[model samples]
Target: MIVNEWCMYCGECAGVCPQCVIEVCETGLKFDEQTCEDCKFCVMVCPVGALEKDEQK
Candidate 1:
């Protein structure tokens, strides 16, 4: 997962993170795929719409 500059630091993504991959940080919100279970729960809850999965295509 990769959080771009568009991140607004909203915690919505973290709230629903099943794997707790998303976390709010002082610099900004971050998404750690290492802890991610590939469950897109957090991706669906981002209010600022800043969260995104790493495009593997």
Candidate 2:
């Protein structure tokens, strides 16, 4: 899980995340990749379209 600069920190993604991978950090939602299963649920649920996968591949 990786919350980029696009995140509004509204916790919108957190709600849909089954693994609870999204957390509100000091800067914003600190995405914990350790618990992430790449389900992409958070990405779809985000109203602001904040949450996203690394997509480095």
Candidate 3:
């Protein structure tokens, strides 16, 4: 997943992630690629369209 500059730092994506791969804090958001299951839940839950699938990968 890719988080762009538009990210609002909301914790919604982290809360809805099924794989527990996303972590949101006061600093920023962190994505654990090792634990991610390619589940698009985070992408879907991001209200600001900050998260997206890394299509180039």
Candidate 4:
């Protein structure tokens, strides 16, 4: 997953991730790509459209 500049740091993406790959902290959002399952749950939950598929592959 890719978090763009549009992120609002609302923690919604972190809350819905089943793999616990996304973490929302006081400073900002933390994403663990190794733990991510490409579930796209975070993308769907992001209200600001900050999260998106890497699409580099």
- Per-residue CA lDDT of model 2 for 1-57, tens digit only, reads 555667777777778889987787676777677788888988898776665588772
Better of 3 and 4 by lDDT: 3
lDDT of candidate 1 over 1-57, digit per residue (tens): 767677777688888887777778897876676677877777677666666777782
TM-score, cand. 3 vs. native: 0.84
Q: How do all models score by TM-score?
A: 0.74, 0.74, 0.84, 0.81
Alpha-carbon runs more than 4 Å astray in model 3: none
Candidate 2 displacement at residue 51 in angstroms: 2.3
Q: What's the lDDT for candidate 3?
A: 0.86
Candidate 1: lDDT over CA atoms? 0.74
Which rank order by lDDT, best down to worst? 3, 4, 2, 1
Taken over the whole model, the C-alpha lDDT of each candidate is 0.74, 0.75, 0.86, 0.84
Candidate 2 regions exceeding 4 Å error are 2-5
| Candidate 1: residue pairs that collide | none
Model 2 earns a TM-score of 0.74
Top lDDT hit? 3
Q: Highest TM-score: give the candidate number.
A: 3
Q: Considering only N, C-alpha and C atoms within 3 Å, which residue pairs clash in candidate 2?
A: none
Task: Give lDDT tens digits, candidate 3, residues 1-57.
Answer: 888999988788999988888988777888888788887988888899999888775
